[model samples]
Target: MAAASIMPPHTNPPPPATARDPTATVSDPQRHRDAPTPSLRALFLRAVDPSRPSSWSTAVADLLSSGDPVAALAAFAAALRANPAALRPALPPALRAAAAATSLSAGRQLHLLALRSGLFPSDAYSASALLHMYYHCSRPLDARRAFDEIPAPNPVIVTAMASGCVRNNLVYTALSIFRSMVASDSAGVVDEAAALVALSASARVPDRGITGGIHALVSKIGLDGHTGLANTMLDAYAKGGGHDLGAARKLFDMMERDVVSWNTMIALYAQNGLSTEALGLYSKMLIVGGGVRCNAVTLSAVLLACAHAGAIQAGKRIHNQVVRMGLEDNVYVGTSVVDMYSKCGKVEMAWKAFQKIKGKNILSWSAMIAGYGMHGYGQEALHVFTDMRKSGLKPNYITFISVLAACSHAGLLNEGRYWYNTMKTEFGIEPGVEHYGCMVDLLGHAGCLDEAYDLIKEMKAKPDAALWGALLSACRIYKNVELAKISAERLFELDATNSGYYVLLSNIYAEAGRWKDVERTRVLVKTRGIEKPPGYSSVELKGKIHLFYVGDKSHPQYKEIYAYLEKLLERIQEAGYVPNTGSVLHDLDVEERESMLRIHSEKLAVAFALMNSVQGSVIHVIKNLRVCTDCHAAIKIITKLTGREIIVRDIKRFHHFKDGLCSCGDYW
Candidate 1:
């Protein structure tokens, strides 16, 4: 009764915790067991002295550190409730560390205790800790509110808020906060640099200016020398597009090098399409290793480099290393494996790796979908997407993009429209330029040229080269020179440097027998010096890729290759194949024209691939340009006479020829 009388009332109690010494850890059980029941004021006064508040807090932390988070969390909550103002700071951090180490239940207990203690509103420090508490517990909204409620927020609170928004995909919100902080020149605050650094890591592509401003602020405030803040700046620069790697390199060079510094540079190079540079940096990282472990992120970066370079051997070695290092099942690593294999044209290997993943994340799903789509396995891609949905995984914009591309390739017009609408109606994903391009390509490939043109014209967003290019391509196939000219003019207006558009228009004029227009187009090409990309054809034999061009005689077996091609031509012609040489736009005599068509890259590659394989084996050819009419006719005859499937993936679409018919049904 006397002790109760000595305690202060709830109305004017002591300040809530978190302002006390970070080192005042409550670390035992005996004191709590034997102590008198002190008043809140007494507890506050005693805690404010900076001595260890209670041994119980430390004991709980020890329990948490030892992986007995249940007990540690329970003990921490009990101690915190005893005198919240005196115990919250010590308990929340310990509880959060405990939660990260072992149990979310421990985190939950600490959070609930904070809420129940009625100290969260009164103490800014406590609120900040609570914000971090919720963040660590994966309750980002709660963390956001806690951060917002901080009376006069610091950089720590601002950083936490930005991180929370980004984790939830509120990229714009994070960007605004970062902009505000920069505008106010909050660089004087020590944590402001850290906040700017953190926000930069999640900033969108357009926010590169903001990110650079933050970096400038960091430099102006003289905090660029801080290693942690510098590393954060490095990550931000990499994530924020349009960053100058020169700046990143300069900062990295001036800083005392750490593993993180090296890793960030390597990742930046890999992410920004400089795969060769990434590999070079990785070599440097290897020579300069200083206890910097090769983390999953680093490994994933190098793996992507392998994908871009098509370095299958290097990727395989990395895969083995990943397994040996016991990181094979890491989701990020698994996703990278799928991507590498897919890009290397090992679709089956990608599928096998995908199946082995215990829990497939959205990235993994997107990678697989992309693999199937790229391999021209449209039906398989659709099936994978269906499976993804059945597994309760929501498809992101990338996923839809892949699926829509598959539909475009397979000419699944209805399915394409369904998904195009679904992304907007069901998923609330606004269609971007890429998405609109896919839709236009879908309708265009389906021979709905009018509808495709209308879609482009009615697009809420402005059309890009891809959209106009699709319509122009459709015109070429449909022999609609009027539409072709209109689309070509629009395309040139939008992108004056696209030589392909001019070349396509010239070809269309040739097809329409407009000699003057063809000459005019050639003159324009000459004046602009727009060099058309040389057409290339590739054939795979015994897993080796053999390449050829229209007049390529580089093969070691050039004589034999020509002899074999001539014999094949005689046989196919004998089988009633008349060379359709009209697609040859070059002015030449009839015999010379026929000769050129015979030696066209696709014909050369196909003839070689056919001769190298078994009699009935299917031949798969990839061509850099659209298959010419003569080549398509020759392939149809070859497939019919030899009874072999000849799958040709040209620039426009896949041509799957079996028996005398193609998937495009002679339309394209």
Candidate 2:
């Protein structure tokens, strides 16, 4: 009863059992088991006395930090019992201990203890601590009530309130507080620390307006040049809604770049699918960044850029750095290497990197799964997933998405369906839009259009446009015009602004001889002012990126690239290769279509790589869109004729063309 009653109502283990001596500060079981032998009191006596509350609280803090929280809490209780008037001085440390222990009941009682002593509302130190404790215990509303009780909040209290609000997902409340601080900075609480908190809040809300205004305010206060503050703002821009990468880059160029500044910019470029730009920045960060040393985050971000850009050479360079820095076994660095190699069409390198990681986390497991999925190795991915489960780790939402995608890419329809159901029914991990998109893609790839449609209709959550768009893409592959129209109709209702859907539908129509529908769809683009993103291919060479659009001639070496491409085209044609002019989607004569197809972006990039690279070296080309049927056929023939392996990483997956056969088995 004493142990149960030691807590106010509901807390575990019961607060050191409230010993008979009132300053016992040791549980009965602990006392019985280890009496007279360095008891908590013996440790407490060296540094503190119960009647001296400050030192006693100091002992509590030291105990907690030294991995003896039970003893620390006991000492805290002993001090409280010895002197009620000392509660004011003791409250902050007690509140912090409560936060560390995540004990809501203990924190609530400390709030009561402060209130009973008539020492709270005005005690700014205790008030700030109470805000922290409440948030740590997942009680934001209580924190707000406590904050409102403070008659004159100071800078520390304001910072704690804003930070707590942000941490608790009350981001708008945090923003409002930040705005209030900005509007009335009589105390000048909008210091670098507080500004960092505000930037973090803006990052969560994804509102560019708020982020820009805060950036301006931070600049007006002359804190813009502060490296740490600048890093926070950079992160806000990257995560905050529309990633204005140009603005982030300009900010980066202006600031005296630190490792964090460089890392943030690199991550921003990677997040926005600007992998080539990311790799370039990583190079600049090392050479020209005033000798800013690369940390795990820095190398990890650059490795991700290398993965997406298929700059295996750059990736290998970073990998060598990882080895040199003795970070070969760091989970973060190792996982990035695994992910980098996996996406760059080097599965063996990925596995070696994965095996070297000492302690694998969910992210590491998921990366390997997605890597196998990318390479169309479904069975291998499942085996890795099984190993992950056996290692006492549970699969999360990302893990299941990777699993389903692996199955889909490998055409393991039954495995995909079973895993989809297993995720929901057994693991209780609800399938998100990405998971559902994987399922739709899988069914569509298998020509189970009706079943995919039925699955969408039966989903508990409403499908987004991307889900329907996945079906539409599958429709393009199979030329299922009726289902394509249905998916397109849903896509229009859900995401009418997306130009890709309209283009996809138009392509489907053109394939089915529905020229009228294709023309109408193309006209709608002009009427609605839809801007389609231009298709381009980029290949990295000698630490620089060369990008090509359809018939791009901006490169200084375009004359040579064009000549090489013409020769390759003539050779491929001689070897029984015929261009599929239907992919053009233009109502041009056959000759014109064939002529346009000859200069497609990937072909130009390939021609450039072939001209520049050593003979028989693998040419890695990254495209912004799907590889058309004609290019696919052309690349296959080119691979055979030249005896060169060409790896084209498109939007969906990797296509490793070697000896006239692709790794995707022509499924993609």
Winning candidate number (lDDT): 2
For candidate 2, give the lDDT of residue 128.
89
lDDT tens digits by residue: candidate 2, 1-668: 01112223222332233332444443333454313333455444444445565765666666556554445555566555555444566668767877877878777877886786666887888888889999999999899898888889998899999999999999999999988888885756799989999989988886667778888998888887789988888888778766666767777888877888988898888877788788888778778889788899989998988887788888899999999999989999999999999877788899999999989999999999999998889999999999999999999999998999999899999999999999999999978888888999999989998888888988888899989999998898889999898998888888878777887898899889998988888777667777556678989788667889876878899998988888898999999899765653543222224444447799999999999999968999989888877789999999999999999989888888999989888886
Candidate 1 regions with alpha-carbon error over 4 angstroms: 1-243, 246-256, 287-291, 421-430, 515-668
- What lDDT does each candidate get? 0.69, 0.81
Candidate 1 per-residue C-alpha lDDT over 1-668 given as tens digits, one digit per residue, 9 for 90 to 100: 11112122132332456433443333433224223222222233334333344544555455545444444444444444454443645655554554354345545555555566665666555566566666656677766766656678876667666665665666777767766666666445445545553445444555555556776766776766677777767776656666667767777777876767777888888778676677777767776765666777878888897666545556777777778877777888989988987765567888987887768999899899877876667889999999999999999888898898888777788989999998999999988888888888888877788888888888888999878988888888889888888888888888877666776777788888987888787676667766546677877566445788876788877778888888888999999889765543553222234444337889888878777888876677768778877889888988888899887777655677899878776755
Count clashes in each candidate, considering only residues at least 3 apart in sequence or on different chains.
7, 0
Worst 10 residues of 1 by lDDT: 1-10
